[model samples]
Target: MADNKTVRFGLLGCIRFASKFVRTVTQSSNSVIVAISDPSLETAKTFAAANDLSPENVAVYGSYEELLNDANVDAVYLTMPVTQRGKWAVMTAEMKKHVLIEKPPALDATELDKIVEACERNGVQFMDGTIWLHHQRTVKIKETLFDSGLLGDVRHMYTTMTTPVPEQVLERLTKEAMGLAGAIGELGWYPIGAALWAMSYQMPISVRAMPSSVSTNSVGTILSCSASLQFGSTTTAIVHCSFLSQLSTDLAISGSKGSVQMNDYVIPYKEDTAWFEYTSGAKFVDMHTGWNVMPERVTFDCGGTEESQEAMMLREFTRLVEGIKRGDLEADHRWPEISRKTQLVVDALKKSVDIGCEVVHL
Candidate 1:
């Protein structure tokens, strides 16, 4: 399966987010953009042209089903809204194509179950568009957390992501939330993922959303939210995500002896490099004065200077897809397993919100 071949990719929607992926697939060594399907023919065609997809290999369709039947596509990227993605993922798998979907892969456990079961039954690899998971910078951090003596016990982690949403957007989301912040599944996905990643994808024992911490509309649409997650008795996590605040996303991890901090964890400030600070073994000086430890800044240069986080994801996806195509491997479950863990926590967070911030038993 590790032969030299390009993994043909089909874009399911021309969502603005898909443009980054278009570039990544075209630039990747083992991937190529071969088809696009969306409701609007012009939207799909324009996107294809802007990306400079070859006309001979790249086809455009006004309907997703037509693209799925093209026979040229080996994999499809689903970029629909979270509530609608589950049905499409199942359809993609049933059509015998590998599926890469946007984050929060499904709205809840029931939908996630359908996606996982379909992918497994159809023998198609499944992954979410959580680009950070595939970033080289995140790779370095994982090493420091697991292998390095820094941040010894992983006792606590805090992750926050917030970006102010316009009135129009808020109006749409308010209607969508129904009663509570139905949009929690969307904006909260990143912080939830960061928390889960910091905890090594272990499901927390329970979750308690911050009571009275959400900003809602008259009908109770969640504009902002915060939650507390408990893992056993020692490990805990805090997550805050909102659509009513200024753009600020951060992560900090602390243990018994030391800590780590980053200003941008969901998406790096730089495309080619990521920055963070870590400290270990802090103690007062012999004179019982200032602390003895000093924080050291570190940066990791991802190999591809032009490769965005999305590019890294496509490169990884294509490599595995290439192997599967060459019969070198079956569907790799590693990515889907991680995705499932993230979704499990996401569902729990929603439950917490649903029950008025009560502790949701996992």
Candidate 2:
């Protein structure tokens, strides 16, 4: 619960995602996007105007430092690139403001540790913007599968996420922006978080990655990854991620009695679809017999004029801001822990790629 009084927010960058976050805050009850800073003044003004925000209500700056120095801001959201996230987290923590950074908080555990320590020392709440952790469907899925144990003893879990790369952004996507680790950073972390939350924080015993390049410069167009995670009592799970082809996402869990499949697991913007199949000796039966067994397709009906990714991210940013102001950060566990474990797997995957797809220990 956020305080009735609004928490003022200053966005560090008016990047594509930041704009969406601003709109989300505007629609929220307990927060306001009071200011924003980017390296481009014209771009900032245009964004403000497009969002129905008065120019006076928004502050445009040519640098991020100015936004950090603003006294009206109670919190800051950093949607910057993964390579630059740690620096901004440290700086924001030092400013005495609550911080919610975009996923893959840092490239590795050591960098994430430094950012976490800085926030702790500064007495500020820190969160990674892994919104699925806050989603109602995810909560229900975990409850039905793990808490109720209705699916029988858990046996295996696997996930895959992939998307086609646009020609204009191919170079940045391959080498600089997120790199292979960073691409997996966003899409991979969600399922990892889901596994950690449902499995009670069990760490994977070993990881192996098979990376293939469709082009030169080691910018592998596709990464076929397999990580074997050993939970207690012989329960094992394998996680997979790739950027090899068209946009497709799926997660399947196998159990003794039945299996549950969550299709389109990573992106909520896509239809939220799932199905359950019960094993009957040699074959399986759809539990919802004769009916559409798929989980109800959920359309992302966001209440905003803008239809960009930034708009979607900003709406959640507002909720997080309100949550911090009211000290309601306990709604989700496994944020910090999942973030750490996700990075560990990603680092291991990178090493596996470097060493010719060898199996690496967790």
Candidate 3:
């Protein structure tokens, strides 16, 4: 980086949702699309054209290694499959380029430790692409969580992200050759990350996955699943994610003082404002004849000029990249720590399910 210049973003893997981040990086003032890499140059070119990148400014490569080796590339936004992310992340780290990866990047804690180690050794930044946590709503929500006079001592949280997979995606996911981790690693990761984030990355003492019903494809990939997390005392969280259900994404947090409830936690339905409600006190009126529910609904722009979570996420990531280049000391550890904790809980949930309702200790 030239200190006064935009951070160069080299996008790796031309996945379906790659366009979202591409658009975000282009919109952000701190970042630019310097290069793109995929298995085919045509595919990369198609992506670049869709995102409206200029051929003279953006380089397209058919190989990820070539993109990583490009001198102009400063950081990489990786949108690869869950299983392949670890390999590419380590490679990116060894190459000394900062990494911003999609969620569930680690298959287990062992792999996550290795990825974290590589980045630390190379003095590069590492962050997972969890969208909602970067939103302005999250900032306000964290403030409310600490105000005991408001939401008080958070106790429990429940979140869900269930949406029907497209026909092409369903076929690719269920194929034996792909051998993907199934819906748990795909749609499940967002809500699970939300649950972990609600408690400030506090590791649960134990985890149990208790899905009432399980559906698998013809090739044996799980289509849907759910789990619960125990925080050892009064705190707990539950999450449900699926690939075989209608579109739905929501989260509710309960506390000693009140509760927080909202929909569209994974992605905002609109770009302008978000909706969430909280309640402080409630009671029955006239001998239980009627109920008085004190619910306060909130709607705000959340300071998002780009509107969507992905855009906000990219802006924040780019800011950190530039800040670090300018010698900021407090930027790197925060993202990697959150990413590691999220992956640790996801690994525990999968282990609990595999062992027949056994409680996996974290």
Candidate 4:
């Protein structure tokens, strides 16, 4: 890592999802993937070839340890399974390399804490792969709905992120090797993060999973579930996540003066522009045929012309890593804090589900 130089990255897994990062990192201006590793050397080589990665530029390794040992590898992007990532992330940090992990960062918050602690102790940066948060649309939403007080005192939030998964895909998702074999761990992270973001990253007082809403596979891997989070006496967030629903990503936030609504909060339908609906001070007309005000459609152009949300995330993480390398800045604690808060809520909700949908105090 050097000032005004590209931050080299080692991708630690050759899974299908890792391909996305391969493209994003290449599209990013500040980062580049220099190495790739998987359990099988042949698989790593094949993945690199499929991605059209030049051998002279990208090293292929059969073991993660070998890639981590490469001095040119400034950081690591963990695309491994949820259960296997924590130790590897800790190892990455221990070797004084920054780590970017895919979400849900771990099976539970306790596990996430260990990874974060390692980064803190080793003076490395740690960020979970929550791409939507890095989108320009998210920045606009924060300004209009939160900072501008357009939504007033927020009282309620509803979010759902789901997609129909085929049987083969569902089997892969629910495999015991994946650790958390459920829609909650796979798709729920978005809504959970969205709810926390709407509440300014505040922790909920309690979480209760709706028992009736929980559906599981033959292996007892959760396929779909819903949960309620009590933020305060007056504020609550309802989240529903599923692998058995029609494709949808919805978020709605209501406050004292207004409400914010969007159908695609996790990933916008279009890459160039994303929009939301906002409404306030509504009343029925004298004839009671319609409301006094209609919801306003607010749209924002995706700010990064060549950068998607995932690209922006890689750029931002690399920027931080560069700053640390330059000694002009310390690791930004905010990213890890956000990750920890989201993990805590997730753990609480999972606990609630395990305890017969009983409310779990945070």
**Overall local distance difference test of candidate 2:** 0.64
Q: Relative to the unseen true structure, what is the Cα RMSD of model 1?
A: 2.4
Model 3 Cα lDDT, one tens digit per residue, 82-184: 6777889999989888899888776666787898899899888888887888877776777765544587877888899899987667656753422344776
lDDT of 1 at 277: 88
Query: What TM-score, over all chains together, does every model reach?
Result: 0.93, 0.80, 0.92, 0.95
Candidate 3 lDDT score at position 58:
91
Better of 2 and 4 by lDDT: 4
Candidate 1 per-residue lDDT over residues 1-362, each given as its tens digit? 12349788898898777888887776676777788988898888888777787678788899899998988888999997675788899999999899999877887767888998898898888998888878776877789755575678789888888888897777677544332435466667787888788777888899888987777766666778899889889998998888888887888989876888988887888787787888888788999978787888887776554456777788778778778778898888888888877778777887788788889988
Give me the runs in candidate 1 sitting further than 4 Å from their true place.
1-4, 174-183, 218-220, 286-289, 303-307
By summed lDDT, which 10 consecutive residues of candidate 1 come out lowest? 174-183
Off by over 4 Å in 2: 1-4, 179-182, 211-233, 269-334
Q: For candidate 2, lDDT tens digit of each residue in 1-362?
A: 22446777877767776665666677655678777777787776776777777767766666778889987777888887777888888999899887778888887788888888787787676778776555545556667656666657777777666666565655556535665564556556665665565566777677666444212225652234445556665676666554555776667777764566666555554323323333312242476344333333323433333432344344455455556557775323334566777777767766766677777887
- Cα distance off (Å), candidate 1, residue 260: 0.9
Give the alpha-carbon lDDT of every model: 0.80, 0.64, 0.79, 0.86
Kindly report which residue stretches of model 3 are placed more than 4 angstroms away from their true locations once superposed: 1-3, 166-171, 174-180, 302-304
Looking at model 3, the pairs that clash are none
In candidate 4, residue 288 scores what lDDT?
A: 100
